[model samples]
Target: MLGQPAQLLEREPYISFLSSSALVIKQWLLFDPMPESDARFLLVDLRQRLPVVSMNDGASFHIADGEPAVASDPAYDGSQPTLIPGQLVPTPVWDDRAGSCNWDAKAVLEVTLADCPPVSDERVRAAMELYVTSQYDFLPRSLYLAMLTVLDGLATGSKRADRIAKWIDEKVSEAEEFNDQSLLDGLRGLKNGSHAAGIRALVKRAVLYLGGSEQEAARQANTVKRLYRVRSQLSHQSDTVELDLARATQLTRLVLNAVVSNPALLNDDAGEEASLAGGRERRTQWIAEAEVAIRRAKPDCAAVEKAIRRPLIMGKNGLLIAHLADRTQWAIDDGGARPVSDEMASEWAALDESFGERL
Candidate 1:
């Protein structure tokens, strides 16, 4: 869309026009709140490049560069949030300094959460390592790949991404029909984010990790699914594509952080495929066991986790701990770093009732 930059000056009437009978300099001097010193500076500039349009009806005007004009009925900020002050976003990246050619540059990314958890430094580091410079094509998938590592690692422990696990099962169970052996192999490689269902599962899991409810996670999954759809267009479609890259990067960062910090979700294979006959019972029982364990453990790491940037500390038995902003202890999954017994689930379940009391 071609922006009407020529009419910008007319639209932004910050300057005051004082009319008079003659085209004399006195008419320009009588402008509202126009200091003589400031008017002289503007007058000098105007003489150099006379405006193309006629001030036939009006005498002259002076542009006030000092104070910003804020109207009582000013426009709303925007749909998105920005931390930067008075951030100006140019319509196009290459807009020039001239008002007719360009506009101001705005902040790159914006993220919002009810309780904004500290960003995961390790994940960022890992992503930065994989992130290709200057090329946009490989980065999104690379970011997704990093998140998938956490998802694949946490897949066994989650009750959330049941749909993704089921999708994986379906793909594997009937691979011949769709030439999906490669897809199956991809799943085997722990890169389950090759499809929409897997991506949704990862999204739901990430939401759950960030202290969100299942319903909320499901809702956010829709957004993740939509993101993947746009991502798909980049690879699959022929037409011109425009994506909200900043939003995508922010979201990917959020998801990657969730997965990185909560790797305990990776060790369990509760979401693995099962036969219709006996598998359903086992799956239900597994879910019930997980729920019972969760109720007993009552993990409060999220409540104390207000750290701006907590350095991950390795504790006894491969357990990771990060001291929160409130000086409370926030624990990471010990089993996540290494293989632990399935019976550890029972012990982990008993963690709330017995372990903390002993300590």
Candidate 2:
């Protein structure tokens, strides 16, 4: 038993390496254009024993311990997928199935270490990690949202700004000189002045710049936009949409592969693109700077508190909207400004005969 434990410890690194390589291969099967099926197979652990396969041609070949295999049968139909053996993976979290060993030698050769994006790039590495983690079947909706979050981080820019710049440029270039001042005056009322593209536009542009055709890029962008609505509903209203796991996962995989193939897609000369490494810090800095500016121009704490206490708006049902000390808006009724529901507000309003006068 002592010798067996020592031997297993010695082979642990080899087993780990194979499992890591299998993750890369699984990504290939998922996104490669020529792979007929992305179905996965079982890689049973043989403990300290080397796994060897005996072919029907009376030849045998040693396989990686983490290499997936299936029971040899003429009637094997690629169902009954299994997890990477020798690990304690939850089987229910995986949808992969066992597939045939009829390997496509050419496809295998097509993918190499060189084709893989360098792990040195933080964004590429992070995106790849997200891609791998997304394979878990735990809460598909959450995973889909998480995929979009990564995409949002990867695709930087303001959609509103892109449209405004395009429209302004087109109007100026194609104008008959008289409309120039009119356009300039019209621009003064613009809500967004920054030239950064929005999340949707950035996503589309990234896909297009990273080798996707115009149509494919547009489709991807549209899909993101639609899903973003679902994200908003889930976030703000606590609502969820029925998600097609395969389609959702495929889109994320395609976007992830594109980003991984070219990390430069995350770069922009204008510095509008958030740096993948210190992006959170940069965002925090911006918020801090904004707060400093607000503080510089604001009154004392007492005055601020007074202003917050004053109602900003009042509803017909006698619900007064005011900012709380923490800057959150709350509905204030007869119960005096607690975090209560609208129904409770209506109830409070109905109780008071002179509520209209108070409002």
Q: Pick the candidate with the highest lDDT.
A: 2
- Candidate 2 local lDDT, 191-294, one digit each (tens): 34333245556555454443333554466567667777677677778554666555455555545544544455555533223223223342344334333333
Against the true structure, what is each candidate's TM-score? Answer: 0.29, 0.36
**Cα lDDT tens digits for candidate 1, 170-238:** 767676577766776866544343445655666565554443335545665676666666656767888
lDDT of each: 0.36, 0.40
Error of 1 at 310 (Å): 19
Best by TM-score: 2
| Backbone clash tally (model 1) | 5
Q: What TM-score does model 2 achieve against the real structure?
A: 0.36
Would you list the clashing residue pairs of candidate 2?
Answer: 81-97, 81-98, 157-197, 157-198, 158-196, 158-197, 158-198, 159-197, 159-198
| After superposition, candidate 1 runs with Cα above 4 Å error | 1-125, 131-194, 266-359
Q: At residue 280, give the lDDT of candidate 1.
A: 35
How does candidate 1 fare on TM-score? Answer: 0.29
